[model samples]
Target: MFRNIKTYREGALIEDEQIKSYVESFESELLRGISTLSALSIIQRHPDEGIYGYQLLKELEQETGRTLIIEEGTLYPILRKLERDELVVSERKDSGGRPRKYYKLTTKGTELYQHMVGFFSKLLEAITPLMDIEIKLPEKKFIYCPNCTNKIPQEAEVRFCNICGLNIEGLSK
Candidate 1:
Protein backbone atom coordinates (compact mmCIF):
# COMPACT_ATOMS: atom_id res chain seq x y z
CA MET A 1 0.00 0.00 0.00
CA PHE A 2 3.12 2.21 -0.10
CA ARG A 3 4.63 3.86 -3.16
CA ASN A 4 8.37 3.75 -3.93
CA ILE A 5 10.31 6.99 -3.99
CA LYS A 6 11.58 7.37 -7.53
CA THR A 7 14.64 9.46 -8.35
CA TYR A 8 16.15 10.18 -11.75
CA ARG A 9 19.72 8.94 -12.09
CA GLU A 10 21.55 10.08 -15.25
CA GLY A 11 18.43 9.54 -17.39
CA ALA A 12 16.50 6.54 -16.05
CA LEU A 13 14.21 6.49 -13.04
CA ILE A 14 15.81 4.65 -10.09
CA GLU A 15 13.88 3.32 -7.10
CA ASP A 16 14.21 1.01 -4.09
CA GLU A 17 17.70 -0.51 -3.50
CA GLN A 18 19.25 1.05 -6.60
CA ILE A 19 18.16 4.51 -5.50
CA LYS A 20 19.78 4.00 -2.10
CA SER A 21 23.15 3.09 -3.58
CA TYR A 22 22.90 5.79 -6.24
CA VAL A 23 22.07 8.46 -3.68
CA GLU A 24 24.75 7.23 -1.29
CA SER A 25 27.41 7.37 -3.98
CA PHE A 26 26.32 10.88 -4.93
CA GLU A 27 26.34 11.91 -1.25
CA SER A 28 29.85 10.53 -0.71
CA GLU A 29 31.13 12.41 -3.74
CA LEU A 30 29.67 15.66 -2.46
CA LEU A 31 31.09 15.01 1.02
CA ARG A 32 34.57 14.09 -0.21
CA GLY A 33 34.99 17.45 -1.89
CA ILE A 34 34.30 19.77 1.08
CA SER A 35 34.85 17.81 4.30
CA THR A 36 38.46 18.76 5.01
CA LEU A 37 37.58 21.96 6.83
CA SER A 38 35.81 20.11 9.64
CA ALA A 39 38.70 17.70 10.12
CA LEU A 40 41.29 20.46 9.83
CA SER A 41 39.53 22.59 12.40
CA ILE A 42 39.46 19.63 14.78
CA ILE A 43 43.18 18.99 14.41
CA GLN A 44 43.79 22.70 14.53
CA ARG A 45 42.03 22.88 17.88
CA HIS A 46 44.89 21.06 19.53
CA PRO A 47 48.22 22.76 18.99
CA ASP A 48 50.81 21.38 21.44
CA GLU A 49 49.07 18.01 21.91
CA GLY A 50 47.85 16.32 18.77
CA ILE A 51 44.69 14.30 18.37
CA TYR A 52 44.18 10.70 17.23
CA GLY A 53 41.79 9.84 14.37
CA TYR A 54 38.93 8.47 16.44
CA GLN A 55 39.13 11.31 18.97
CA LEU A 56 39.28 13.84 16.18
CA LEU A 57 36.19 12.33 14.59
CA LYS A 58 34.30 12.42 17.87
CA GLU A 59 35.32 16.05 18.50
CA LEU A 60 34.29 16.92 14.93
CA GLU A 61 30.85 15.45 15.58
CA GLN A 62 30.58 17.36 18.87
CA GLU A 63 31.84 20.61 17.39
CA THR A 64 29.28 20.48 14.58
CA GLY A 65 26.59 19.61 17.13
CA ARG A 66 26.37 16.01 15.87
CA THR A 67 25.20 17.07 12.43
CA LEU A 68 28.21 15.68 10.54
CA ILE A 69 29.36 12.10 11.10
CA ILE A 70 32.34 11.42 8.85
CA GLU A 71 33.50 7.87 8.18
CA GLU A 72 37.11 6.64 8.64
CA GLY A 73 37.36 6.00 4.88
CA THR A 74 36.96 9.72 4.26
CA LEU A 75 38.88 11.09 7.28
CA TYR A 76 42.15 9.20 6.70
CA PRO A 77 42.45 10.27 3.07
CA ILE A 78 41.90 13.90 4.03
CA LEU A 79 44.54 13.61 6.78
CA ARG A 80 47.01 12.16 4.28
CA LYS A 81 46.25 14.99 1.87
CA LEU A 82 46.83 17.59 4.59
CA GLU A 83 50.10 15.93 5.57
CA ARG A 84 51.21 15.93 1.93
CA ASP A 85 50.33 19.63 1.71
CA GLU A 86 52.57 20.29 4.73
CA LEU A 87 49.59 21.75 6.52
CA VAL A 88 49.78 19.20 9.31
CA VAL A 89 52.25 16.75 10.84
CA SER A 90 51.62 13.37 12.41
CA GLU A 91 53.66 11.39 14.94
CA ARG A 92 53.23 8.00 16.47
CA LYS A 93 53.36 8.19 20.25
CA ASP A 94 52.68 5.92 23.16
CA SER A 95 51.05 8.37 25.55
CA GLY A 96 49.69 5.88 28.11
CA GLY A 97 48.81 2.57 26.50
CA ARG A 98 48.71 1.62 22.81
CA PRO A 99 50.61 3.67 20.28
CA ARG A 100 48.49 6.14 18.33
CA LYS A 101 49.21 8.47 15.46
CA TYR A 102 48.38 12.00 16.54
CA TYR A 103 47.92 14.85 14.12
CA LYS A 104 48.65 18.56 14.66
CA LEU A 105 48.77 21.65 12.52
CA THR A 106 52.13 22.88 11.32
CA THR A 107 53.11 26.57 11.36
CA LYS A 108 51.75 26.93 7.84
CA GLY A 109 48.60 25.13 8.85
CA THR A 110 48.04 27.55 11.74
CA GLU A 111 48.27 30.54 9.41
CA LEU A 112 46.06 28.87 6.83
CA TYR A 113 43.54 27.95 9.49
CA GLN A 114 43.33 31.56 10.64
CA HIS A 115 42.73 32.77 7.11
CA MET A 116 40.26 30.02 6.32
CA VAL A 117 38.29 30.57 9.51
CA GLY A 118 38.21 34.28 8.82
CA PHE A 119 37.14 33.77 5.22
CA PHE A 120 34.48 31.28 6.28
CA SER A 121 33.14 33.70 8.89
CA LYS A 122 33.01 36.52 6.37
CA LEU A 123 31.45 34.22 3.80
CA LEU A 124 28.76 33.29 6.27
CA GLU A 125 28.11 36.94 7.11
CA ALA A 126 28.09 37.87 3.43
CA ILE A 127 25.64 35.14 2.52
CA THR A 128 23.37 35.64 5.52
CA PRO A 129 21.16 38.14 3.72
CA LEU A 130 20.61 35.73 0.87
CA MET A 131 20.03 32.81 3.25
CA ASP A 132 17.70 34.91 5.40
CA ILE A 133 19.93 34.32 8.41
CA GLU A 134 21.85 36.59 10.76
CA ILE A 135 25.49 36.29 11.89
CA LYS A 136 27.27 38.88 13.98
CA LEU A 137 31.01 38.34 13.84
CA PRO A 138 33.13 40.24 16.36
CA GLU A 139 34.45 43.06 14.20
CA LYS A 140 36.51 44.45 17.05
CA LYS A 141 38.41 41.20 17.51
CA PHE A 142 39.34 40.87 13.81
CA ILE A 143 41.36 42.80 11.29
CA TYR A 144 39.83 42.78 7.82
CA CYS A 145 42.84 44.09 5.97
CA PRO A 146 42.12 47.03 3.69
CA ASN A 147 44.24 45.71 0.84
CA CYS A 148 43.38 42.03 0.60
CA THR A 149 40.30 41.82 2.85
CA ASN A 150 41.63 38.51 4.18
CA LYS A 151 40.20 38.25 7.66
CA ILE A 152 42.58 37.83 10.59
CA PRO A 153 42.45 38.33 14.31
CA GLN A 154 43.71 41.57 15.87
CA GLU A 155 45.41 39.64 18.66
CA ALA A 156 47.91 38.14 16.22
CA GLU A 157 51.14 40.12 15.86
CA VAL A 158 50.90 40.58 12.11
CA ARG A 159 52.72 43.45 10.46
CA PHE A 160 51.76 42.68 6.88
CA CYS A 161 48.79 40.67 5.69
CA ASN A 162 49.86 37.06 5.25
CA ILE A 163 47.90 36.67 2.02
CA CYS A 164 48.50 39.95 0.18
CA GLY A 165 51.61 41.32 1.95
CA LEU A 166 49.74 44.50 2.75
CA ASN A 167 51.30 46.71 5.47
CA ILE A 168 48.91 46.48 8.40
CA GLU A 169 51.14 47.38 11.36
CA GLY A 170 49.83 50.93 11.49
CA LEU A 171 46.30 49.68 11.06
CA SER A 172 46.73 47.19 13.86
CA LYS A 173 47.43 50.02 16.26
Candidate 2:
Protein backbone atom coordinates (compact mmCIF):
# COMPACT_ATOMS: atom_id res chain seq x y z
CA MET A 1 0.00 0.00 0.00
CA PHE A 2 1.25 3.41 -0.91
CA ARG A 3 0.66 6.50 1.18
CA ASN A 4 -0.59 9.37 -0.97
CA ILE A 5 1.90 12.18 -1.21
CA LYS A 6 -0.92 14.72 -1.35
CA THR A 7 -1.95 13.83 2.19
CA TYR A 8 1.27 15.23 3.62
CA ARG A 9 1.75 18.96 3.67
CA GLU A 10 4.72 20.17 1.68
CA GLY A 11 7.88 20.75 3.71
CA ALA A 12 6.25 19.17 6.74
CA LEU A 13 7.13 15.44 6.68
CA ILE A 14 8.22 15.88 3.11
CA GLU A 15 10.99 18.27 3.96
CA ASP A 16 13.77 16.92 1.75
CA GLU A 17 13.47 14.65 -1.24
CA GLN A 18 16.46 12.59 -0.20
CA ILE A 19 15.28 11.78 3.31
CA LYS A 20 11.53 12.34 3.11
CA SER A 21 10.45 8.70 2.92
CA TYR A 22 12.95 7.66 5.58
CA VAL A 23 11.84 10.47 7.83
CA GLU A 24 8.16 9.73 7.28
CA SER A 25 8.60 6.01 7.85
CA PHE A 26 10.77 6.60 10.89
CA GLU A 27 8.18 8.67 12.74
CA SER A 28 5.36 6.35 11.70
CA GLU A 29 7.30 3.37 12.97
CA LEU A 30 8.37 5.16 16.12
CA LEU A 31 4.79 6.15 16.89
CA ARG A 32 3.38 2.69 16.32
CA GLY A 33 1.61 1.30 19.44
CA ILE A 34 1.80 4.71 21.15
CA SER A 35 -1.96 5.35 21.00
CA THR A 36 -2.45 3.75 24.41
CA LEU A 37 0.06 6.13 25.97
CA SER A 38 -1.46 9.08 24.11
CA ALA A 39 -4.96 8.21 25.24
CA LEU A 40 -3.77 7.73 28.80
CA SER A 41 -2.04 11.11 28.73
CA ILE A 42 -5.21 12.89 27.61
CA ILE A 43 -7.40 11.11 30.12
CA GLN A 44 -4.92 11.94 32.88
CA ARG A 45 -5.34 15.61 32.00
CA HIS A 46 -9.09 15.45 32.73
CA PRO A 47 -8.45 13.64 36.01
CA ASP A 48 -11.71 14.29 37.79
CA GLU A 49 -14.11 14.05 34.81
CA GLY A 50 -12.33 12.01 32.12
CA ILE A 51 -12.61 12.74 28.39
CA TYR A 52 -14.44 11.67 25.24
CA GLY A 53 -13.06 10.35 21.98
CA TYR A 54 -13.30 13.53 19.94
CA GLN A 55 -11.74 15.58 22.68
CA LEU A 56 -8.93 13.07 23.03
CA LEU A 57 -8.22 13.32 19.31
CA LYS A 58 -8.20 17.10 19.37
CA GLU A 59 -5.92 17.26 22.38
CA LEU A 60 -3.59 14.62 20.96
CA GLU A 61 -3.10 16.74 17.86
CA GLN A 62 -2.82 20.01 19.68
CA GLU A 63 -0.47 18.68 22.37
CA THR A 64 1.81 17.04 19.86
CA GLY A 65 1.69 19.98 17.47
CA ARG A 66 -0.06 17.66 14.99
CA THR A 67 3.00 15.46 14.73
CA LEU A 68 0.97 12.51 15.98
CA ILE A 69 -2.48 12.07 14.56
CA ILE A 70 -4.79 9.17 15.43
CA GLU A 71 -7.80 8.70 13.23
CA GLU A 72 -11.21 8.03 14.79
CA GLY A 73 -11.42 4.71 13.00
CA THR A 74 -8.30 3.54 14.85
CA LEU A 75 -8.88 5.24 18.18
CA TYR A 76 -12.01 3.38 19.20
CA PRO A 77 -10.35 0.00 18.85
CA ILE A 78 -7.39 1.12 20.90
CA LEU A 79 -9.72 2.48 23.56
CA ARG A 80 -11.62 -0.78 23.60
CA LYS A 81 -8.38 -2.68 24.08
CA LEU A 82 -7.40 -0.38 26.90
CA GLU A 83 -10.76 -0.95 28.51
CA ARG A 84 -10.47 -4.70 28.06
CA ASP A 85 -7.02 -4.64 29.61
CA GLU A 86 -8.40 -2.76 32.64
CA LEU A 87 -6.23 0.25 32.08
CA VAL A 88 -9.25 2.49 31.63
CA VAL A 89 -12.84 2.43 32.74
CA SER A 90 -15.68 3.96 30.78
CA GLU A 91 -18.66 5.78 32.21
CA ARG A 92 -21.74 7.08 30.49
CA LYS A 93 -22.73 10.60 31.41
CA ASP A 94 -25.49 12.99 30.40
CA SER A 95 -24.03 16.22 29.29
CA GLY A 96 -26.66 18.79 28.32
CA GLY A 97 -29.11 15.89 28.04
CA ARG A 98 -26.91 14.06 25.58
CA PRO A 99 -25.29 10.81 26.65
CA ARG A 100 -21.58 10.28 25.98
CA LYS A 101 -19.01 7.78 27.07
CA TYR A 102 -16.00 9.16 28.86
CA TYR A 103 -12.85 7.31 29.85
CA LYS A 104 -10.78 7.59 33.02
CA LEU A 105 -7.63 5.82 34.00
CA THR A 106 -7.82 3.05 36.55
CA THR A 107 -5.35 3.04 39.45
CA LYS A 108 -3.26 0.49 37.59
CA GLY A 109 -3.40 2.67 34.52
CA THR A 110 -2.31 5.75 36.39
CA GLU A 111 0.75 3.99 37.76
CA LEU A 112 1.64 2.65 34.33
CA TYR A 113 1.18 6.06 32.76
CA GLN A 114 3.57 7.65 35.23
CA HIS A 115 6.20 5.06 34.46
CA MET A 116 5.74 5.49 30.74
CA VAL A 117 6.15 9.25 31.02
CA GLY A 118 9.29 8.81 33.09
CA PHE A 119 10.75 6.25 30.72
CA PHE A 120 10.03 8.44 27.72
CA SER A 121 11.46 11.50 29.42
CA LYS A 122 14.61 9.60 30.29
CA LEU A 123 14.81 8.34 26.72
CA LEU A 124 14.68 11.89 25.38
CA GLU A 125 17.16 13.17 27.92
CA ALA A 126 19.56 10.36 27.13
CA ILE A 127 19.43 11.07 23.42
CA THR A 128 19.58 14.85 23.68
CA PRO A 129 23.35 15.11 23.52
CA LEU A 130 23.43 12.96 20.42
CA MET A 131 20.62 14.99 18.87
CA ASP A 132 22.37 18.23 19.84
CA ILE A 133 19.21 19.46 21.53
CA GLU A 134 19.11 20.40 25.19
CA ILE A 135 16.08 19.42 27.26
CA LYS A 136 16.02 21.12 30.61
CA LEU A 137 14.23 18.90 33.10
CA PRO A 138 12.55 20.63 36.05
CA GLU A 139 14.49 19.03 38.90
CA LYS A 140 12.90 21.42 41.38
CA LYS A 141 9.48 20.00 40.66
CA PHE A 142 10.22 16.33 39.96
CA ILE A 143 12.98 13.79 40.20
CA TYR A 144 13.54 10.65 38.18
CA CYS A 145 13.74 7.53 40.30
CA PRO A 146 17.23 6.10 40.08
CA ASN A 147 16.01 2.51 40.15
CA CYS A 148 13.42 2.55 37.39
CA THR A 149 13.48 6.10 36.16
CA ASN A 150 9.91 6.67 37.25
CA LYS A 151 9.07 10.34 37.70
CA ILE A 152 8.26 11.40 41.24
CA PRO A 153 7.18 14.80 42.47
CA GLN A 154 9.92 16.40 44.50
CA GLU A 155 7.40 17.67 47.04
CA ALA A 156 5.62 14.35 47.51
CA GLU A 157 8.00 13.15 50.25
CA VAL A 158 7.74 9.63 49.01
CA ARG A 159 10.12 6.91 50.18
CA PHE A 160 9.79 4.86 47.02
CA CYS A 161 9.05 5.23 43.37
CA ASN A 162 5.30 4.69 43.22
CA ILE A 163 5.56 2.59 40.11
CA CYS A 164 8.59 0.47 40.86
CA GLY A 165 8.58 0.29 44.65
CA LEU A 166 12.19 1.42 44.66
CA ASN A 167 13.46 2.94 47.89
CA ILE A 168 13.88 6.66 47.25
CA GLU A 169 13.96 8.18 50.74
CA GLY A 170 17.71 8.59 50.75
CA LEU A 171 17.59 10.54 47.50
CA SER A 172 16.16 13.49 49.41
CA LYS A 173 19.34 13.83 51.44
Candidate 3:
Protein backbone atom coordinates (compact mmCIF):
# COMPACT_ATOMS: atom_id res chain seq x y z
CA MET A 1 0.00 0.00 0.00
CA PHE A 2 2.75 2.47 0.95
CA ARG A 3 4.87 1.44 -2.03
CA ASN A 4 2.05 2.21 -4.44
CA ILE A 5 2.30 5.95 -3.64
CA LYS A 6 6.05 6.12 -3.13
CA THR A 7 7.83 5.46 -6.44
CA TYR A 8 9.11 7.78 -9.13
CA ARG A 9 11.54 7.06 -11.94
CA GLU A 10 12.07 9.83 -14.44
CA GLY A 11 8.39 10.64 -15.16
CA ALA A 12 7.06 7.29 -14.11
CA LEU A 13 6.37 5.73 -10.71
CA ILE A 14 9.21 3.87 -8.94
CA GLU A 15 10.19 2.56 -5.48
CA ASP A 16 10.59 5.14 -2.68
CA GLU A 17 13.63 3.28 -1.38
CA GLN A 18 15.56 4.16 -4.55
CA ILE A 19 14.83 7.87 -4.03
CA LYS A 20 15.86 7.70 -0.38
CA SER A 21 19.10 5.92 -1.26
CA TYR A 22 19.94 8.45 -3.96
CA VAL A 23 19.36 11.39 -1.60
CA GLU A 24 21.46 9.85 1.17
CA SER A 25 24.33 9.14 -1.22
CA PHE A 26 24.24 12.63 -2.69
CA GLU A 27 24.13 14.32 0.68
CA SER A 28 27.00 12.22 2.05
CA GLU A 29 29.21 13.00 -0.93
CA LEU A 30 28.53 16.71 -0.66
CA LEU A 31 29.05 16.84 3.12
CA ARG A 32 32.36 14.95 2.81
CA GLY A 33 33.85 17.89 0.92
CA ILE A 34 32.60 20.63 3.26
CA SER A 35 33.06 18.87 6.61
CA THR A 36 36.64 20.02 7.04
CA LEU A 37 35.75 23.63 6.38
CA SER A 38 32.81 23.46 8.75
CA ALA A 39 35.02 22.06 11.50
CA LEU A 40 37.67 24.68 10.85
CA SER A 41 35.13 27.50 10.97
CA ILE A 42 33.82 26.28 14.33
CA ILE A 43 37.33 26.14 15.76
CA GLN A 44 38.19 29.55 14.33
CA ARG A 45 35.22 31.17 16.07
CA HIS A 46 36.66 30.23 19.46
CA PRO A 47 40.24 31.24 18.81
CA ASP A 48 41.19 32.40 22.31
CA GLU A 49 39.70 29.42 24.14
CA GLY A 50 39.96 26.01 22.55
CA ILE A 51 36.93 23.68 22.37
CA TYR A 52 36.76 19.95 23.09
CA GLY A 53 35.57 17.32 20.60
CA TYR A 54 32.02 16.75 21.92
CA GLN A 55 31.50 20.46 22.39
CA LEU A 56 32.64 21.12 18.85
CA LEU A 57 29.99 18.72 17.54
CA LYS A 58 27.34 20.43 19.66
CA GLU A 59 28.39 23.85 18.41
CA LEU A 60 28.24 22.71 14.81
CA GLU A 61 24.71 21.48 15.33
CA GLN A 62 23.64 24.66 17.10
CA GLU A 63 25.24 26.96 14.56
CA THR A 64 23.75 25.17 11.58
CA GLY A 65 20.27 24.83 13.18
CA ARG A 66 20.84 21.07 13.42
CA THR A 67 20.78 20.56 9.69
CA LEU A 68 24.44 19.44 9.60
CA ILE A 69 24.37 16.47 11.91
CA ILE A 70 27.63 14.59 12.27
CA GLU A 71 27.97 11.48 14.37
CA GLU A 72 30.11 11.63 17.54
CA GLY A 73 32.43 8.85 16.38
CA THR A 74 33.16 10.52 13.02
CA LEU A 75 34.28 13.85 14.52
CA TYR A 76 37.50 12.52 16.12
CA PRO A 77 39.08 11.27 12.91
CA ILE A 78 38.51 14.67 11.33
CA LEU A 79 40.09 16.41 14.32
CA ARG A 80 43.06 14.01 14.23
CA LYS A 81 43.59 14.70 10.54
CA LEU A 82 43.49 18.45 11.11
CA GLU A 83 46.01 18.13 13.94
CA ARG A 84 48.30 15.88 11.85
CA ASP A 85 48.31 18.51 9.08
CA GLU A 86 49.37 21.18 11.62
CA LEU A 87 46.35 23.32 10.83
CA VAL A 88 45.18 22.96 14.41
CA VAL A 89 46.83 22.19 17.73
CA SER A 90 45.38 20.08 20.51
CA GLU A 91 46.19 19.60 24.20
CA ARG A 92 44.67 17.46 26.89
CA LYS A 93 43.00 19.16 29.85
CA ASP A 94 41.73 17.37 32.95
CA SER A 95 38.07 18.21 33.50
CA GLY A 96 36.59 16.69 36.66
CA GLY A 97 38.14 13.20 36.28
CA ARG A 98 38.40 12.51 32.55
CA PRO A 99 40.95 14.16 30.31
CA ARG A 100 39.34 16.05 27.48
CA LYS A 101 41.33 17.17 24.45
CA TYR A 102 40.71 20.73 23.31
CA TYR A 103 41.58 21.98 19.84
CA LYS A 104 42.34 25.43 18.48
CA LEU A 105 43.36 26.75 15.08
CA THR A 106 46.97 27.62 14.42
CA THR A 107 48.03 30.64 12.35
CA LYS A 108 47.99 28.48 9.24
CA GLY A 109 44.46 27.38 10.00
CA THR A 110 43.24 30.94 10.45
CA GLU A 111 44.74 31.99 7.11
CA LEU A 112 43.26 28.95 5.42
CA TYR A 113 39.84 29.67 6.94
CA GLN A 114 39.96 33.21 5.60
CA HIS A 115 40.85 31.94 2.15
CA MET A 116 38.04 29.44 2.31
CA VAL A 117 35.58 32.16 3.32
CA GLY A 118 36.57 34.29 0.36
CA PHE A 119 36.32 31.34 -1.99
CA PHE A 120 32.88 30.42 -0.68
CA SER A 121 31.68 34.01 -1.02
CA LYS A 122 32.77 34.20 -4.63
CA LEU A 123 31.28 30.80 -5.37
CA LEU A 124 27.90 31.81 -3.91
CA GLU A 125 27.95 35.09 -5.83
CA ALA A 126 28.71 33.27 -9.06
CA ILE A 127 25.94 30.76 -8.55
CA THR A 128 23.25 33.08 -7.16
CA PRO A 129 21.95 33.98 -10.60
CA LEU A 130 21.63 30.33 -11.54
CA MET A 131 19.46 29.51 -8.56
CA ASP A 132 15.69 29.40 -8.93
CA ILE A 133 15.04 32.13 -6.38
CA GLU A 134 16.38 35.66 -6.54
CA ILE A 135 19.02 36.62 -4.01
CA LYS A 136 19.68 40.09 -2.60
CA LEU A 137 22.63 41.71 -0.90
CA PRO A 138 22.26 44.03 2.06
CA GLU A 139 21.37 47.63 1.23
CA LYS A 140 24.35 48.98 3.11
CA LYS A 141 27.30 49.86 0.88
CA PHE A 142 30.26 47.48 0.84
CA ILE A 143 33.68 48.63 2.00
CA TYR A 144 36.76 47.81 -0.03
CA CYS A 145 40.12 47.16 1.47
CA PRO A 146 42.38 50.17 1.01
CA ASN A 147 45.40 47.92 0.66
CA CYS A 148 44.14 45.30 -1.80
CA THR A 149 40.67 46.53 -2.86
CA ASN A 150 38.96 43.35 -1.69
CA LYS A 151 35.25 44.11 -1.29
CA ILE A 152 33.72 43.46 2.13
CA PRO A 153 30.19 43.93 3.31
CA GLN A 154 29.58 46.87 5.60
CA GLU A 155 28.39 44.67 8.43
CA ALA A 156 31.36 42.32 8.45
CA GLU A 157 33.21 42.12 11.77
CA VAL A 158 36.61 41.68 10.24
CA ARG A 159 39.69 43.59 11.42
CA PHE A 160 41.95 42.58 8.53
CA CYS A 161 41.67 41.93 4.87
CA ASN A 162 41.58 38.15 4.40
CA ILE A 163 43.31 38.49 1.03
CA CYS A 164 46.04 41.05 1.81
CA GLY A 165 46.40 40.62 5.60
CA LEU A 166 46.18 44.39 6.01
CA ASN A 167 44.75 45.82 9.22
CA ILE A 168 41.41 47.32 8.12
CA GLU A 169 39.59 48.21 11.33
CA GLY A 170 40.41 51.92 11.12
CA LEU A 171 40.04 52.03 7.36
CA SER A 172 36.53 50.57 7.30
CA LYS A 173 34.98 53.42 9.22
| Model 2 lDDT tens row, 1-173 | 12334476666646666587776677666665576788889999987899989889999988987767876678898899989999899999987788989999999888888888888888889999998999987767778888788888888878878887988885754
In candidate 3 the C-alpha lDDT for residue 36 amounts to 80
User: Residue 144 error for model 3, in Å?
Assistant: 8.8
Model 3, stretches more than 4 Å misplaced?
A: 1-15, 134-173
What ranges in model 2 sit over 4 Å off?
1-25
Model 3 over residues 33-110: C-alpha lDDT tens digits? 477888988898888879898989999988887778776788899999999999899989988699999899999888
In terms of lDDT, which candidate is strongest? 2
Model 1 lDDT per residue over 1-173, tens place = 01123345665545456876877778767666447777888887898899999899888777777656687566898899999999999999997799999999999988877777777777788899998999998878888776556777788897889988988886744
Task: Report the C-alpha displacement of residue 97, candidate 3, in angstroms.
Answer: 2.8
> Which consecutive 10 residues in model 3 have the weakest lDDT in total?
1-10
lDDT of 2 at 112: 81
Q: How accurate is candidate 2 locally (lDDT)?
A: 0.81
* Residue pairs with backbone overlap in model 2: none
